[model samples]
Target: KTTNMPERPFDSENARKKQHAEQSNNELDENSPTNNNEQSGDEEDDDENQIKGNEEEDYQEDDDEETPDFTDDEYGSEFTDDYLCPELMAERPQEHESLNNVIIVDNLPKVDPAKLEKLKEVISKVYNKFGVCRNVYYPLDKDGKTKGYGFFEFQNEQMALEAVKQTDGYRLDKNHTFSVTLMSEFERLTQVPSEATDIGNLLSWLTEPDAVDQFAVQSDDPKKTMIYSNALSQPILLEERSKWTETDFVWSPKGTYLASFHEKGIALWGGKEFRQVQRFAHTGGVQHIDFSPCERYLVTTSARPGNSEAFIIWDVITGQKKRSFPVEQGSPYFK
Candidate 1:
C-alpha cells in the first residue's frame, strides 16, 4: 500500500496549474479564430448565392417583357382594305386628247383599178381640201384588193373630224358609198400617228406618184372593174373582180389580205397581186366573215332564208373547213 501510494505524490501548485491549463484549453476550443473564420465564410457564400438568385430573377423578367403578341388587332387592319379592287384603283391619265384624231371610213364598195386610182385621187382632193399632208394607209387584202373600208389618221382631231364630215356619204366612185366617223378612243391611241397633225394630208402624200396612165373603165356589171397604170411608161390594164357577193369586208392584220363573203363562198386575197389564195364553198350564201388575231383560222356564217343557219371555221393555210355549227334565228353574231 505504501509503494502504490508513493507514486501519486504531486505538488499542489503543479496540480492546480495542470487543471488551469486544461480549463484554458477548453475555453480556447469553444472560441477558436479558425471556427469563427469558417462560420463567416459560410455566411458570405450564402449572401453571394442569394444575390445571384435575385439577379437571375431580374434577367428572366426582362426577357418576358420583350416578346410581342401578333393576335392584337392593331397589326394588319390597314393593309387588307386598300388594294383589293384593281379596276377602281387604276389611275387615269391627267391629260386626254380628243378621239377625233382617228378616222374610220365605212360602206365602201369594191373598186377596180381605174376606180381605185380615182378613189385615191378623191382622197387626195379631200386631204387638199383640208390643207393637211399626213400619210394615208389603205391596206389591201391577200389578192391585192382593197378591203372596202380603211382607216385614216390625222395630225390632229380637228383635221380628222374635218375629213369625216367632208367625206362621209361623199361619193368618189359610182357604186361606192363611204361613211366616216371618229375612231374609237382605243384605236386612236394605237393607230393614229404620234406626231401627225393632219391624217388627210398624209393620205394625199401616199397616193401621189410621178406619172398617170389611163385605161377604159372595165364594166358596169357591178362585179367587174378595170384598172390601168402607166407609171412604168407603158400602158397596163387589168380586170379587177371579187368573188364575194356580200358586203362588210375586213382586212388582215398586216393590211396585206382581204376577207369577204359571197353568195356561194368565202374569199381571201393578197393585196399586191389580185389572186385568190383562199376559197371556201358553201351551200348557201356566206353572210359574215371574221379572222382570228393570229390569222390561223377564219369563221364564216352561212344563213339563207327558210334554211337553218350554219357557221364554219376554215384553216387559213389550206382553206379547208375545220368545224361547223348550226345557229338559231336571231342568235349572236358569233356562235
Candidate 2:
C-alpha cells in the first residue's frame, strides 16, 4: 500500500528563482528611483552610501565596550562608592580637643617626587571646593611615590563631611580614586594612643608635706580631695564623703582651701596636713557653693524639704556671715 503512491519531485528551478529575487532586493539602494520616470543614482552617491554604512557598523560595535556604571564591579570598583572606606562615614567627635576633623584620603594616584608639589596643589584646590581646607599632607617614600594617599584637615568637621559626601566615589583623573576617612580611625586601628609621663614626673614628690599645694576635688570619687599629709609621709586621703554627695567639691582660687560637702554643711580644709579650716553650717546640708572673684566672699545655698531654701554669704578671711537670704524651694539663685 505504501509503494502504490508516487512521491512528488522537489522543485529546484522555482527555488533558484526565489533566491535570485532576494539577492536583487538586498542590492537595491534605499534612495534610488523606484519607477522608470524617476532619476537614477550616480557614482558619487554610491561612495557616500558606503561611508554611511561603515559608520553605523562602528556605532553598533561600541555598545559592547561602554561602561554601565563606575560603581559596578565591571569597572574594577577601587575608585567607586561600593569600595569606599567605612571610616569615611564615622560619627563626630565625642569630646573636645579631638582629632576628628581630619580626613584621611588614601589610594590616590602615585606621582613622581618632583611632581608631588604640583599634585599637592591640585589636590588642595579640588578639596577646597567642598569646605575650608586647613592643610593638606602628602607622605612620600625615598622614591617620592605619593604613598598613594594624603590627608586633608578641614577648618571644622562640616567641611570634611561635605568633601566625603560629595566626592566619595568621584573619579580623580583616570586611574586614581579617593578613600576618605577620619584621621582618628586611622590612629585607633593602626596604633595605640600615645601617653605623656611628664605630669606624673612633675608631681612625684607631692607625697611630702612641704611640696603640698594645688589639689583636684572630685565629687564622685571616694575621697573628695587628695593632698600631701606630712603625718603619714605619703599621699593621704581626707574629707571622705560617706553619703551620696549631690554637690561638687571645689578648690580655692589660690589652692589654699579645699571645700567639700557633708551631712553637716560645707567644710573648708587648709594647712600642710590638710586640717579643718572652717565649716559653713546649714541645717539640712549645703547643696552648692561659689566663691567671689577675689576669694574674699563665699556663697552657700541649702534647699531642704517643706521649708524655703536658704542662701548665706560668708567672709572667707574671718568666716563671718555677710548676708542671709531665703527663697522658695527649687528657685535659682536670687537675681
Candidate 3:
C-alpha cells in the first residue's frame, strides 16, 4: 500500500461543523424580526376573517329560527294574567261602617273590682229603661280599678242617640254624674290631624320595606292575646289586650277580622282600635266557630240545654241568625 496509492477525500469533524454553521446562519436571516412580523400579521388577518364568518353564520341561523307559539296551550292558558299577577285582581277594600250604635259614658265613679259588677248593673238599669243595652264595657286601670269611663253599645243608632240625650249630665248620685256622648261625636271632637292619620292606620305595617310578616299569639291566660310583627332582629308587639277574649281567639280567613269567644256570644273585632265590629249572640254559649269561605257568614256551635249541640249560622254583617239546627247527644253531628 506504501508504493503508489490513489488520493482519496477524507470526512473530518471540522468540515461538517462549518457546513452546519452556514445553514444555521441562513435560517436566522429568514426568521429575523421583520420577516416574523409579516408572518404574524398574515395569521391575525386570517383569524379575524374566520371570526367574522362564524358570526355571520350565527346571525343567519338566528334569523331563520321560528318563535314558539304559546297561546291556548295548557301552560299558557293556565298562567293567564289573573294567575300570574293575582294581586292586581284582588277584591276592593272592605267597607268599614260607622260606629253609631256605641256611646261613651264618662265621669263615672271609679270603684274597686269587687264592686264593678254591681256598678255595671246599676248603670245598665238606668240605660235599659231607654232602650235595650247590648253591651257595657268598663276599662280598668293597672291597679284593677275602674277608669271612671265606660262604653255602652245599644241595639241601634237611634237607641244610642236616645241614651245620650237622656243620660248626658244626668246625676247618678251625689258624687258622680253621667257625661254621656256618642262615640262618633267624641271621635269627631278628638280627631287627629290629617297628617297624623297614618299613625292610626291598621294596615300601615304592610308598608314596611323589609316586608315583615305578622302573627298573633294567645297567652296562657285565656283573656290575653297579642299581635306581633316578625322582624329579622326580634318580634315586636304591635298590639296587646287583656280580656280580649273569654276563652280563645281566631282570625278570619282573609285576616281582616278577629273573632273573640265569650259566654254570651262571639264578638268580631277589627280596624285600628280593634273595636267590636259585630256581635253574634249565642246565648247557649259558643264552643267552636267557623267562618264561611267568603267571610260573609259564621257558623257557631254550642252546647245547649238538654244535652244537645246547637249549630247556628249567622249573617256576619247584619249579625242576624240564618239557620239553626239542634243535634241530639247521640246524633252523628253531635261533635
Residues 1-335, candidate 3, lDDT per residue (tens digit)? 47876645554677788999999998998799988999999999999999999999999999999866766366466567768778875653222213688889999999999999899888888889878787788999999999999998787889989988988999989999888888778766686644422224445556789988777898874567998879999998988998788788888887768899999889987765676778888876788899988899998888666634388889997777889877666422333
- Candidate 3 or 2, higher lDDT: 3
Q: Please, what are the lDDT tens digits per residue for candidate 1 over residues 1-335?
A: 35454444567778999999999998897689987898899999999999999999999999889565688888655664335655654553222232456676776666665577766776666666665636566767776677787676667777777787788888766876787777654464457434522213212212537635333243435754444455566767644564243544566654445665566777765423445656788767777777788888888777655554488888987666798877667643864
lDDT of 1 at 333: 88
For 185-240, candidate 2 gives per-residue lDDT tens digits of 77556875455222222223355546654444454555333443344355555434
lDDT of 1: 0.65
TM-score of each: 0.29, 0.30, 0.37
Candidate 3: give the clashing pairs: none
For candidate 2, the lDDT comes to: 0.67
Identify the superior model by TM-score, candidate 2 or candidate 3.
3
Regions of candidate 1 where Cα sits further than 4 Å from its true position: 1-221, 224-239, 242-248, 305-309
User: What are the lDDT figures for the candidates, one per model?
Assistant: 0.65, 0.67, 0.81
Superior by TM-score: candidate 1 or candidate 2 = 2
